[model samples]
Target: MKLVRYGAPGAERPGVLDAQGRVRDLSMLLAEMGPAQMSPRTLAALATIDVERLPLADAGVRLGCPLGGVGKIVCVGLNYRDHAQEAGMAVPAEPVLFMKAVTALSGPYDDVQIPPGAQKVDWEVELGIVIGTRLKHVKKEDALGHVAGYVLANDVSERAYQTERGGQWDKGKSYDSFAPVGPWLVTADEVGDPHALDLWLDVNGQRMQDGNTRDFIFDVPTVLSYISGFMTLEPGDLVLTGTPAGVGLGQKPQPRFLRAGDEMRLGAAGLGEQCLKCVQS
Candidate 1:
């Protein structure tokens, strides 16, 4: 089932997509699609609801981040071999982890504001994992069982702040609108094989990044398990499992960056799509 949140930004209501590709209100059933509703049991229960009977949302309603009350947004850097090669970095033995401030979260199609004086703004299309259960030091074999769902994400970055003026990558990664995720929170059962999905991103109608999750140097389970060992993985925690090559910083001849009015379109097969406009703050 495709889970969603619809309506205005803060007042968005929980919804599920019906077979006709229409929004079906889940407001009467779930107050918010937050941590409490992310567990395997909760999701299983939700799956049993007859979406056809639920109230249909207004046509063309705005979609907000699919899951609410999200915890820390953890990201794996250079987890894709191609991305590592393009960036002139070697693949690490362990997952490279970083934090993206939760405040950076925005709707999939929302306008992404370019922070003042920022240059080198870039895009990274990646598979996002949503934790469903509390986990600590989980084994890789068991890690996937704790996942609630999957969503596509764009890890927008400012290279100057990230590599030049930064102590940690968070300085460049944590800007508001930097992490636009979800058109739907596809259930784990529906996704089936997260590592095999094809993902791509385009800037202003030009295809820039085109890659598959199968190229991930450290796959989802490994990244999740590794993260759980260092810090507890709680429900609703989002993990961006890295992007394949073709980011603006890795462009041929010269690097390209986002300017006001630039548009971005990206998606992962089955996870849905995101279309964003870059705007000056």
Candidate 2:
């Protein structure tokens, strides 16, 4: 089932997409899509409800981040070989991890604010994995079993703060509205072969990044297990598998960074798409 949250930004209520692709209210059945609701047993129970019978929401309503109670937003860097090559870096033997402040979270379609004193804003289209259960020191073979689902995410970055300032990438990555996630949370069962999906990004109607997950140097199970080895993975934690090649900074001739009034649209196959506009902070 494609679960979602809809309505205004802070007032969004729980919802699910019905068979006809219409947004149906799930308020009466559950509080929201969080760790508790995403558990295998809870999701199994929600499957019994007749989605068609739920009230159809007005198509004009705005969509919000699909899940609530996001605990941590972990990111993997240079997970794609082509991306690593473009950035002039060697593919690491282990996943390069970083953290994006949870405050960076915003509705998928919300405006992306170019922070004050910021230049070289860039876009990264990635596949985000949502954890459903606690896990630590799990084997690669069993890593994916802890995932609740997947969603589309835009890992917006500020190059100057990320590289020139002399600190971890986290400083450049964790900004308000930097992490636009959702449209919907697609369960793992419905997303077969996660590594084979096609993903792309466009800036102001111009296709900038076009790549497939098959190019990932570290696959889903490996990434999850690797991270869990160092830290306990809790429910509601999100892991953003890195973006592919074609980011603005990697462009030839000249770099094309995001500016005020720029727009970005990105998506992963089956997870749905996100349309965000950039505005001055």
Candidate 3:
């Protein structure tokens, strides 16, 4: 089941993507795709609805971040060993967690805003986990049970603000339009094994990041459970599982960065794709 939210930015209506790739409105049944709609119980109830009877949305409309009322966007850095190596950083003993301001959330195909004086803007294509229930100190075995679904995300960053600034990674990562998520919030069942999926990112139609989740140093379950041990995982919260090794910063002697009018295309198996146009804000 591919859950969706469509319409203009601030006035989205809940919907779902049918098997043949049509959008079926769910707004009549569920007013909004928020914490209530994101819960496991609500999802189960939603599955019982006959999609064919639902109104067909127009051919092409703006898709908002699948889930609304998102509380926070958590991220695990260097979860992929190769990514850590490419960044010339040591493999962390545990997941290196960070928070992305929820305001950064944007529609999948939206243009990524380049902040003023942004010199080292970069991109990190990552798999985003959506929490279904509140969890705290949960065991590793129960981690998957708490996940609502997965969404494709571009963890856009500004290297200078992330490193050069004498502060945390928040400024570099939490800019508005920094996190463009979702073509769909694919249900866990449809996604099958998140561990073996093929995920990649292309810059201006050229492939730059290509890797599988199998190489993750600390897989999804561990990362989630590890996080739950310290912070409360609330429904509608998103967790980004980190990117592979091919980020622009990982390039040879001279690293490349995003420029105005540059395009970024990325996707993962089962999950849908995302296309972002970079622009100066």
For every model shown, what is its TM-score relative to the native structure?
0.99, 0.98, 0.99
Instruction: Give a tens-digit lDDT track for model 2, residues 1-281.
Output: 89998988778899999988889999988877777887888877878888889999998678888988898999999999999998999989889999999999999899999999788999999999999888899999998888888999999999889999997999999999999999889988888788999999999898999999998899999999999988998988899999999998999988889999988988889999999999999
Query: What TM-score does model 1 achieve against the real structure?
Result: 0.99
The true-versus-predicted C-alpha distance at residue 198 of model 2, in Å, is 0.3
List the global CA lDDT of all models.
Answer: 0.94, 0.91, 0.91
For model 3, the superposed segments whose C-alpha errors exceed 4 Å read: none
lDDT per residue as tens, model 3, 47-117: 88888889999998989898899998999999888889989999999899888999999999999999988
Candidate 1, residues 136-245: lDDT per residue as tens digits? 99999999999999998999999999999949999999999999999999999999999899999999899999999988898888999999999998999999999999
154: Cα error in model 2, Å: 0.5
Query: Candidate 3: minimum summed lDDT over ten consecutive residues — where?
Result: 34-43
The top-ranked prediction according to lDDT is: 1
